[model samples]
Structures are given as structure tokens and as C-alpha cells.
Target chain A: MLYIALKMLMADRAKYTGLLLGIAFTAFLVTFAAAYFSGFMTRGFALIAENGAADVWVMDAAVESVEQTINMPDSALDRIRGVEGVRYAVPLALGTVDARFPNGRFQTFQVIGVDDATLAGAPVLKDGGVPTVLRAPDAAIIDDGGTSGKLLTPVLKTDQWPHDGAHLEAAIRELAVGDELLANDQRIKVVGRSETLPRFPPRPLIYTTFANAARILPQERHLLTFVLATAEPGLSPNDLAQRIHARTGLRARASEDFKTDTVRWYLVNSEDVGDMAAMLILAMSVGFGVTGVLLYIFTYENLKQYAVLNAMGATPRVLLSMIFAQTGICALTGTGLGLGACVLVGEITAKAGYPFRMMWFTPLLGTVGVLIVSLTAAAISARPVLKLQPAVVFAGR
Target chain B: MSTDANHEIAVRCQGVTKTYGTGVAQVAALRGIDLDVRQGELLMLVGPSGCGKTTLISIIAAILDKDGGQCKVLGHDLEQMSQNDRVRFRGKSIGFVFQVFNLLPSLTALENVAIPLLLNGVPRGRAEERVRSALDSVGLGERMNAYPAQLSGGQQQRVAIARALVHNPKLIVCDEPTSNLDHKTGQDMMDILRGVAQSPDRALIIVTHDPRILGFADRIAYMDDGRITDIIAGKHRGQLQ
Candidate 1:
């Protein structure tokens, strides 16, 4: 009888295809929205993700997220290093500077300054250069995102000279080990290129030493952006963070907790979440509207056949099973197709540097949503079937 | 077509009454009806349109409830059984043929014939074997794989009959089985139905208005205005009324 039910559903190819498309569209929209949100959240904390060696990050009490930092005083690092469970603490400076490329193009680059001796927060370089490369005069490492993107310079020296008005099209090349840029009228050299995770809002990165950053940036009373610390062997990062906060009256968080805080801050402040939620709601509405109405029509049209089955000894339970079986098939197949499509699109968008990630939970969420749509459709359609009078089969007589 | 005194009664109805709708729209369809159907017999109920033949048969088949009546089918009182029990009893003991044939268009003749057996919890392989034999008995063995639309009107009717008999139910009820056919096809259908009634433990009740198939009945009951006006033996068919 379940086999027969499938046959009956497939007999009307138009309606069957309509139902599948409706469910598939819903799954696709829901999954795409979730994946987009996940991608944005991952990128929101990309800096913390790349600096994996740090167990805790200490900042001013007013700081909320890594992106919105309030620079701490230089004495904060010494205060944190003096705590009982702290192994060591290093100073980290974060600031944005106007960098003039060899092609006479100017762009704002995010500058990260690590400790001069340890270079604890330095990103891994593509050529495996030692961190001692930053010790050279006016040396810096350009991140891969910058070399391939905003830092592209003309290959010809003639094109490197500044023009008066509009920019000219020329053959260009990525910044290499010897490429030079000017920061605040000071000449800086790119000693290496590092591969780091792409950031939200997609700013290019420049890594240099703490002493070099002080020279490149304007003098200020508080230039230390954060204090990176490691915990002792026996102490957990959370416990160390709590101790640092208690002793210094500064904001301190475990590395993982800081990442989560960064993501939560963006979710609360940005409009992206509301937009994604609206898209999800619209997808669910379309799913319910189209699938529900079509299923109801399909059942209503076949009421006579159901009546014959009823008269032939099919109990109401049997009839309900057949209906659910039909809807379940639609739900499973539609969810598979939709999830497959989302993964394919994710691969493409990831290559193009768009924020799109298909996490495991995203697909699971889509499957649950599609199942609800199918169950609602089955319930709405089964009402008329259960209420049909078998004697109606003999009505024309 | 004859019934012996020892043959068990398949259906017993007394003072069966049924009404449709309520309030100002109320209309009585069956009023104070008494009838008995015995095994090894073919009974025909003839009547005008809206004369309650369908209503009474619906009550006897346990698909509809009677307003006030004592209706017993296959030795079980239908009014006293729970809905699930009544449905199970009807599935195991009764078969039905509708006026429109009511064949699911998507299924092949073989699958259509296997429905009753499947509903009775028969395994697929065994049900297919029984369905093949049933279709063969109805002279549709060659066209068992054809869909309903692919078969002609007479062929579809034969498939419906095979479906009715596939589960080997003790009682078969048909409503206007031959009215949609030509005279030759109608007579052929009657011949097939008469052959089915030859079993000593099986009974058939047909409600129809066609006069050409009257000779196939063992007894005919004439109904009009929601009541049975007269009944006569098949040998005295000319004395209807």
C-alpha cells in the first residue's frame, strides 16, 4: 500500500515536481542564510583564531571586542606579568596607518605590533622565515591578503611614480620580499609574506615589531592595545584570566571566550542577523504556503479513490500511513538536494573571498525545517481524507 | 442461483432507517427496511434514483451507520462494534464494487487486484500469486499489467470484480456494476458475477436498475420512496411491483 501511495503521488508529475521544488527552495534559502551567518561569525574572530599561542588577552576595562579596542597603558603588561599564575606577558600594539604603495596608491592597513624579543603573536610566514627578520631596519611582514589584494604595485618603475589626477592601468605584481612602502613619510620594507585567515570587513594586515610600531605611529600616553599572556602548567586559562582581572582591575578573558565575545558583539550590533532571520522566515512561509496548498489539492482531487479504498477495508490508520509516507519522501529528497546545492555554492563563494561556510549544524537545521513543512502538509491534507464518507463512492447512482 | 435451508445467513436487517442532513434540510434516505441475504444466493435490489438502495447497502457493508436498526453482517452486529473493529471486520469479510469502478488509475490491474489481500496483511509475494489467479478467473490474465486508462471499459470492470474476489470475502456487495456497459458487456459481466455466486459459502448483493441482467438474480426486491414495495422470486421477474 505504501508503494501504491507513491505510485499515485507520482502519477501527477506536475504536482509532484511542484511539491519537490517548493521544499527544495525552502531548504536552500534557510541553509544559505545560516551558512552566511556562520561565516561572518568565524571571520569576526579571525584575529583571535590566528593567535593560537596566547591563552589570555588583557585589555582596558572599557573594551568590548577585539575589533573595538581601547588601548591599555604600557604598565598594564607589567602588572599582568607579576600575577601568580602568569608564565609571561607581552605587549601588543594595534593601530591603522596610511600606507603608500610603490604604484602611488594609498590604502589604510591594519598594523599589528608583537613583542620585540618573543614575537609571540606573529603569523606563520609562507617562506618559513625566522621572526628575527623583523629585527632588520624598518622591516615588516605583509599578510597574504594584502600582497594579493590592496598592496598590488605596478611592475614598471615608470608606473610606480605618482600621477597628478586619475590612475592609469598597468601590468601589476604582488608585493614580494623586497617590496617597499612608505608609512607616515618613513620608508618600510616587506621582509616576508604570511598567510593568515581573512578578516571581517577585509582590511589588509602589516606585521612589525613593538619598537618599530612606536616609531611609525604617532606618540601617545597609552599605545599598548592588549597584553597577551600564557598560563602556568597547573593553572587553566580561565582561572588565570579571573586572577588577572581581580588583581589589575582590567578586562581579561580566555582566548576562546574572547572569540565568542567578539562574535556576540557583532551579532548584537549589526543588521546582518535581522536580515538573515527575515530570509529564514520568508523561506518557511513559502514552504508552508506552496506545499500545504498543493498537497491539500492533491488529496481533495483523489478523495474518490480514497473512498473506494475505505470501502474496500482500509482503516483510517492505514490511510494516514500512506499520506505520511508520501510526504516523508518529499522531505528527505528535497533536503538532500538543497543541502548539496548550498555546499556547491559555498565552495564557489569561498574561493571568491565571500563569507559563506556550511557548518554541520546548518544542514541539520535545514533538514529539521523541511521535515516540519512536510509534516504540516501531511496533516492538513489528511483531514479531508479521514472525514470522507465511503458511501460517496456510490453517489452518482 | 438457489439457496438451501442449511445455508447460513450473510446479512440480516430489520427496521433500518437513515436520514441525510438536519434541521430544515433534512431528508430521509432509508425508512423502516427489512431484508435478509443468505449464502449461495444472488440478490438484486432494483429501484428508482434516490430510492434508498445505496443507503441500505452502505449500512449493510458497515461503511455507514443506520439511524435506527438492527443490522447484522457475517454474524456480527455492526452498531455494537467499535469503529476500528467494524473497519477490520468489513475488510476481512466484505468486498465492494462501485458504480464508477473506483480503480486507482496509477496502479496496474494486478496491483489493483492485490489491494484487498494486502489490506488483510497478506505478504506481497503471496498476494501477487492470489491476484494472478483472481484475474485469471475473471478472464483478465493477459492484461494484468495494464493500467486502468490503458484498459477498455469492460476490461476495467473485470479488474474491479477480480479485486472484489481476490481476498475471498464471504459477502460481496456491488452497486450498479453493469450500468456503464453495453448490453453484450453487461451480460458478460453478469455471467462472471453468477459464476462467483456458485460457491456455497459466498453471497452477493447487487443494487442496480438495469433490466437486462434480471435473469441472473436468485431473488429481486423492488424499492421506491425509501421503502421496499415488493419482492419476487427470479422465476417470476415479470411480476415486479
Candidate 2:
């Protein structure tokens, strides 16, 4: 009987194909949306991820996330270092500075300042150079993320501009170790390129010594954005953070807790989250909507066959089982194809620098969602079949 | 199948009554139908349109419930059986052939013929073996793999008949079995149905309006306005004409 049910469903080629594609499309869209969301959330805490050596981050009491920071006075760092369980503390500064590229084009770059002596929180350079390379005079390390886009510099010198009314067609290339830029009218050399995790709303990144950053940027009264600290051996980071918060009277979070806080802040404040949610809801509506209508039509068209079977002594339970079998087959096949397509697309997009991550839960959620759609379709298709009177087979006579 | 010297009653209906719809739209389809079908007999219920022939057969097949009456098919009281019990009983004891052939268009003739046996919990391999023999009996063995749309009207009706007989149920009910076929094809269908009724433990009930196939029945019950009008032997076809 189940075999017959399958045959009946597959006999109508158009409806069968429509149903498969509808479910597969739904699965694909749902999974892609979820993976994109996961990728964005990961990027939301990317800075915290790159600064892996920091056990705890102490900030102003009103600062909630790393992205939105309130600079503490220089004295805050001293107070944090003086707290119990704090092995040592370093000042980390974050601010934006407009840099003039070689082509005379200006772009704003996110500048991160690490401690001058220990060079804590510096990203690993791509060329295998140590962080001590930043110790060079007026030196900065440009992150690889911005090298190909915003920081791309023309090979031609500024004086070599084609002034004869001819197209210059400047041969531009990524900024590298020997390139130079101007920030606040001060000359800075790019010492190396570091491979840091990409950031949300991707921006060019510049890393320099703390003292060099103060000299290159405009003067300010409160220059310290955060105090990065490490815990002593055998002492937990959470305990150190608690001690720092108590003594400094500021917000202190373990590294992992800070990452969570940053992600939570984005979830609450970012419009991008709402856009992703709307896309997910739209996918579900379209996927379930098309599949449900097609399935209902298929069942309605076969009502005569069901009546015949019913008259031939098929119980309601048997008939219901047949509908479920049909729905289950569609769900499994469609979801498998959808998830496979998602992984393939995710691979391509990730290479193209798109925010897409396929976590283990992404496919699981897709399968579960498709199963729900299939079950709803089955329930709706089963109603007319269950209520069908076998006598209907004799009606037209 | 051997004949029994003492004839056994296959279906007995007493004061069976049924109604359809409600309020101003209420209509009576069966008014106290009292009829009996004997084992090894082919009984045809002949009636005009809107008469109770279909309603009576539906009740006997256990597909429809009667508003009032005592009805027993194959010695079991239908009113006494629970819904599940009735379904199981119908699956085990009754078979049906419908007008327009009602064969599932997607299934091959052999698979369609195997439905009743499958419904009775017969394993597929065992059921297919019996289905082959049943199709062979209907002279449709060569067309077993053909879908209904691929076969002629006569062939499709033969497949429906084979389906009706595949499980070897005690009672077989057919509604308008020959109405959709031409003269020669209709006669052929009647011949296949007559052969199935020869089994001594089984009885056949056919609800039809076609008078051309009147000679094939052992008895014909005439119905008018939801009431049984007359019962005449099939040999007295001249009287009906």
C-alpha cells in the first residue's frame, strides 16, 4: 500500500517536481540565512577573538561592548594593574584616523594601539615577522583585510599624474611592507601586513605602538579605551576580572564573557539582525506555502482513488500511514539536496570573502524545519482522506 | 470450488433504512430494504435513477451505515460490530468493483489487483502470486503490467474484476460494472463476473441499470423510489422487458 502511495505521488510528474523544488528551495534559503547570521555574529566579536592573549578586559563602567567604548583616563590602567590577581595590565587604544593613500585618496582606518613594551594584543604578521617589527620609527602594520580594497595604492608616483588630458589608467596594487601613508599630516610607514579576522562592516585596520598612536593622532584628555590584563598562573580569568571590577570601579569581563556581551549588543542594536530574520521568515513562508498548496492539490485530485481504496477495505489508519510515507520521502530527499547545495554555495561565498559559516547546527535546523513543513502538508492532505466516505465511489451512479 | 447441497445465505437484510442530508434537504435513499443473497448466486439490483439500488449495496458492503435495521453479511451482524471491527471484517470478507472501473491510474494492473490482498495483511510476494492467478482467470495475464490508461475499457474492467476476486472474499459487490463498456465489452465483463460468482462460498451483488446483461443473473431485484418493487428470476427476462 505504501508502494502504491508512492507510485501515485510520483505518477504526476509536474506536481512531484514542483513539490521537490519547493521544499529544496525552502531548505536552501533557510540554511543560508542561518549560516549568514552565524557568520555575522562571529564577526561581531572578531576583535576579541584576535586578541587571544588577553585574559580580561577592563573598561569604563558605562561601556557595554568593545565596539562602542568610552575611553577611561590614563589613571584607570594604573588602578587595574594595582588590583589583586592581576599579573599585569596594559593600555589598549582604539580610534579612527583618516589616512591619505599614495593616490591622494583619503579613507578612514580603524587604528589599534598595543602596549609599547610588551606589544600585547598585536595580530600575528602574515610575513612571519615578530611583533617587535612595530618598534621601527613611525611604523604601522596594516591588516590584510583592507590591503586589497580600501588601502590599495597606485604604483605611480603623485608627480607622475598624466596632465595632458589622457586617461592615466593607474596600475593599482595592494599596500605592502614598503608603502607609506599620512595620518593627521604625520608620515607613517607600513612595516608589515597582519592577518587578523575580518570585522563587521569591514574597515581597514592599522596597528601601531601605543606611544606612536598618541603622537600620530590628535591629542585628547582620555586616550585609554580599554585595559587588557592577564591572570596569574593557577588563577582564573573570571576571578581576576572580579578583582579588577571591584578595585577599579569599572566594567571588567573575562575574554569569553566579553565576546558574548559584544554579540548580545549587536543582536539588540543591529538592523542587520532584523534583515536576516525577515529573510528567514520569508523563506519559511514561501517554502511551506508552495509545498502545502501543491500537496493539497495532489491529494484533492486523487480523492477518487482514495475513495476506491476505502471501499476496498483500507482503514483510515492505513490511508493515513500512506500519506505520511509520501510526505516523509519528500522531506528527506528535498532537505538532503538543500543542505548539500548550501555547503557548496557556502564554500564558494567564503572564498569570495562573503560572510557565510556552516556550523553543525545549520543543517540540523534545516532538516528539522523541512520535516515540520512536510508534517503540516501531510496533516492538511490527510483531512479530506480521513473524512472521505467510501460510498463516494458509488455516487455518480 | 464445489457446490453445497444446502444453500447458505451470504447476505440477509431486514428492515434496513437509511437517509441522507438534514432539515429541508433531507432525502430517503433506502426505505426498509429487505433482501437476501445466497452463496453461489449472482443477484442484480435493477432500478431507475435515484432509486435505492446503490444505497442497499453500499450498506451490504459495510461501507455505509444504516439509520435503522438489522443487517447481516456472511453471518455477522453489521450493527453489532465496532467501526474498527467492521473495517477489518470488510477487508477480510468483502470486495468491491466500481463504475468507471475505479482502478488506480498509477498502478499496473497486477498491483491494482493486489490491493485487497495487501489490505488483508498478505505479504507482497504471496499476494503477487495470487494476483497473477487472478489476472489469469480474467484473461488479463498478458496485460498485467499495463496501467489502466494503457488498456482498453474492457481490459480495465477485467482488471477491476480481477481485483475484486484476488483476495477470494466471501462477498463481492459491484456497482454499474457494465455501464461504461460497449455491448460486446459489457458482455465480456459480465462473463468474468459470472465466473467469479461460481465459487460456492462466495456470492455476488451487482447494482446496475443496464438491461442488456440481464441474462447473466440468477435473480434480479427491481427497485423504485427507494423501495424494492419486485424479485424475478433471470430466466424471466421477457417479463422485465
Candidate 3:
């Protein structure tokens, strides 16, 4: 039976080849695009999440997401720290700041100011440790991912060229590493250039002390946007969030909630990213539709052979099983080949710095889509087998 | 119903009726026809178009349901059995040959012939072994891998015959088997069918209008307008001469 089914596939190799290509192309594109989008969102929110922080983000009630500014009193941290099951509550400032290199290269960077001596949000900077630069009042750390608002690659040391192009804070990049920046009229030096792991295109973040951010924008700078606190043994994040919300009129989220919120906020508001993801889904859907049609037509064209089998004393069930077997093979092959091609193409594109990423299970989802389309096609063609009049073989008379 | 008939009777049908559609639109394709194939006898069902010859052959093979009748093939009541059982019964007890060869285009000659045996749960190795001997018997040993489109009409019919014989079924039913063949090729096909009737354990039923095959059958059953008219002994035609 396997031989016969495979023979059928081989006999129509040209046609099946077309079908497989369609399935493969869709699987490749959709999986690769979806992975890149998800990866980007994950990387963006990972730093805050890695801190493993306070359950409640004490902010002005109007702030919708983490990135939004909502200054609370400095005393709120002391109060939250004293709550039950709260291991520790520390002040955290989340705001975008401008950083400059001497070469007129400026970029916007997320200014994550932590009261802890170590810079919490710099994310494993490679060139220099965030701990040393962030602890000093006059010295600060800059994210290589943080986009320098300027594009000068000439002046910085041979290795200090800005790799991250996305600028979030406009104030950071124009200042030279050794030069003084008047943040709120107080001079602060960019002592070192540091980069987080996998900093492809830098976000150009400036890691500073909370007091230093206050000097840059006194009105915008206040108590940290949210504090990080770990739970004691047997304490739950939900319960802790409730406690913080009750006392501060602020919303608290589990560690997962912050990550989810960041992704949700980006998806809902970022038109570019949303459009990209939507386009991929659309392409994936087309792949599904194409595969479905190709598979259905192949099944339909092969219907006569099946009917002939029926006339030759094959049971309808046997014929149905054969058809299904053929469909299953087609779906798996197409999806399998598609995933392989996606990885290959994605690797090539990623090496070229094209932002191509393939998730481990995105191809599985692609396969699921292929199967859905395939089964639908199979179901449609299968109807004829049920309705097939075995008497039709003798119809030519 | 047949205590007197020998156990070797390969097909027996009693009072079978088949109709198409319902009410005023219905046409009775067969009207209460009785059929029987004894032991290894080669029977020809001869009738004009629409005479229910094909329908009768199909019902006997369990390919079509008899509207009213008890049809037995190899001692199993086809009408009484469930659809699945009938399928197993057909795969096990019967082989079918049709006009136009009806070979699955996607499969080679060897693969097509081995299908029934495969569906019967015969392992691929065993099926290929049987198919090899069957095709060799039909003189198609050199063309086993040739697809249906590559074979001539007579050769295709020969492959169909091999497919039927590969499983060593108790009964073989050929629906207008020679209608698509030329005079000489039809004679060649009848000769091929004759070689496979090697034992009394198997029987062949040929539904054909070709008078050239008249000499190959032990008896020829005649029908018109969906009713059997007569059965002539084709074997003793020389005696008539």
C-alpha cells in the first residue's frame, strides 16, 4: 500500500513537485517572518523582565504601559519595600535619554536608572561592565544598541562605531565619550561604550544613576517608573500585586505580565511591526490556499484511478485510506521541505543582517496551516469517492 | 437453498433485482435474475447494451449491491454481508477485469497488478512474488515496470488479468473484457484468461459481446432487456458442428 501510494506520488512527480514548492515557500516565509517579529519583541522586553522585579508597578493610574512615564513619590518605594512577602523593593527609572559620541553620532537610548550600584538594564554589556560606569555620579554607560542620533562612524575608536540604528531617546549620542553633557545644566561624562549581547543595531541607551537622569529632565525624571522586588518563599505574585495596588492606586503585574504587556503594546500600536506580521500571515494563508488547491486537484485527477480500484474490488474504505495516506505524505513533505528552506534562507538573510529569524516551532505552525488546507482539500475530493458510482466504469456503452 | 449444488460453485445468485433512481424516474436495470457459476467453469454473460449484463456481473462481484437477492460468491452471501465485509470478501474471493483495462495510471503494471493482493494485507514482498508469477503467466514479465499509458490495449488487459490472478481469487469477473481489443488481440486475451483457470478452485466470468471468445467458455448465458434468456454450452460447439 505504501508502495502504491508512493508510486502515485512519483508518477505525478511534476505536479506534486509544484505543490511541494508552494507549501515549502509559504512555510519558509511565514515561519521566518513570524520568528523575527516575536524575537524582536522578546529582546526589547527581556531586559526589564530579566530583573525579576516588583509585582506592582506603582505609577500614575493613567499610564497604560511600562514605557509610559508616571512619576510616583520617592517614599512609595520605601512603603512597597515594607509590604508582606515582598523581599525587596528598589527604585527604577525608565525613560528614554539622548547620548552622543564625539563624531556627531547621536542616538536615543532607554535610560534605565537603578538605585542598585550595578546598572540593571544595560544587559551584559561587552566592551565595559555596566557596574563600574553606572555607579559613579559623573560617569555613565551607553547602550551600543541605543541608536546614536548621529551617523558619524569616523571619529569613534576603531571598535566604537554604533551598530544599533534605532534611536529612541534623542538626547544621548551627540556628546563625545570624554566630553561633558549638561543634563539639566549639570555635566556628566560618557565614560564608556558598552553593548548588550547580540546588539545588532544598537538602541543607544544611557545607563545612569537616578540622580543623573533627574538632572537631564527634572520634570520628566522622578521616582523610578516601577520597582523590582522578589517574593519570599511561598509568596505569589498575584497576591503581592493586589497588596501594592491597594496601597498605591497603581497596577501590579506578574513578571510575565510585564513581558506580555510590552509585546501587546508594541503589536497594538506599532504600525510598521503590525503591518509586517500581517503581511507574513497573509503570505502564509496564501501558501495554505495554494497547497490546498494543488493537493485537491491532484486528488481529483487521481480519482479515476481510485474508482478503477473500487471497480477492481477495492473497498471504498480502502480507497479512502489510500487517498488520505497520499494527502498525509504530501502535507508532511511540503511542510518539511518548507521548514528546511526557511532555515537555510533565514540563515543567509540573517548573516546579511536582514533581520530574518526562524523560531523552532513556527514551521510546525506552518505545517499545521498546510494540514488544515490539505485536509480541507482532502475532504472536498473525498466526497466524490463516497458519491462515486462504481457503475460508471461501465458507462461508455 | 442449494443443498444439491457442489461446494465448488464459485457464484450463485437467486432472484436479484436492481433499479436506478426512484418512483417515476426509476429504471430497473435487472429484474429478478438468477445466476450460478459452478466449479471452474468459464461463463460468458452475453447481452445487448442495457441488458443488465454488467450490473449482474458487478452484483456477483459485490461491486454493486443487488436491490433484492441472495448472491453468494465463494460461499459468502454478498447481499447479507456488510459493506466492509463485502470489500474484504471481494479482495479475497474475487478478481475483476474491465474493458479499457482500468489500470491506475499512476502505478506501473507490476504495481497495479499487485494492488488487490496488497489490499488483502498480503505483504509487499509476497504480493510482488505472486505478481511476478502472474505477470510471467500472462507473458508480461519484461514490462512489469511500464505504466498503464505505456502498455498497448491487449497488454493492459493482460496486466489486468495478472492483477486478478495475483491474489489467486476464487472467482474472476471480466466486464466487457474484450470489447476494446481487436479480433486477434481478443483471441490472445481469451487465451491468456484460459491459462489462469488452472484449477477447479477458481472460476472466470467473461461479460462480452465478442463471438470470437465463444469457444473459450464452457457455457454462455444470454440476456435481453435485463432478463436471462438462455444458457448455451460453448464447450460443445464442435459437437454442433
- What are the per-candidate TM-scores when only chain A is compared? 0.86, 0.88, 0.81
Query: What's the distance in Å from true for residue A199, model 3?
Result: 11
DockQ of 1: 0.67
* Model 3 lDDT at residue B97: 85
TM-score of the second chain in each model? 0.94, 0.93, 0.93
Candidate DockQ values, in order, are: 0.67, 0.65, 0.45
Q: Residue B241 of candidate 3: its Cα lDDT?
A: 27
Model 1 over residues A197-224: C-alpha lDDT tens digits? 8777677888999988887776677789
For candidate 3, give the docking quality class from DockQ.
acceptable
What overall lDDT goes with each candidate model? 0.84, 0.85, 0.72
Judge candidate 3 against the unseen true structure and give its global Cα lDDT, from 0 to 1.
0.72
Clashes of each: 0, 0, 32
- The lowest-lDDT stretch of 10 consecutive residues in candidate 2 chain B is B1-10
Cα error of candidate 3 at position A233, Å: 11
What is the C-alpha lDDT profile of model 3 across B111-207, one tens digit per residue?
8888888888888888888888999999999999999899999999999899888888888888888889899999888888886643567778889
Q: What value does the lDDT take at residue A286 in candidate 2?
A: 82
Q: Is candidate 1 or candidate 3 better by TM-score?
A: 1
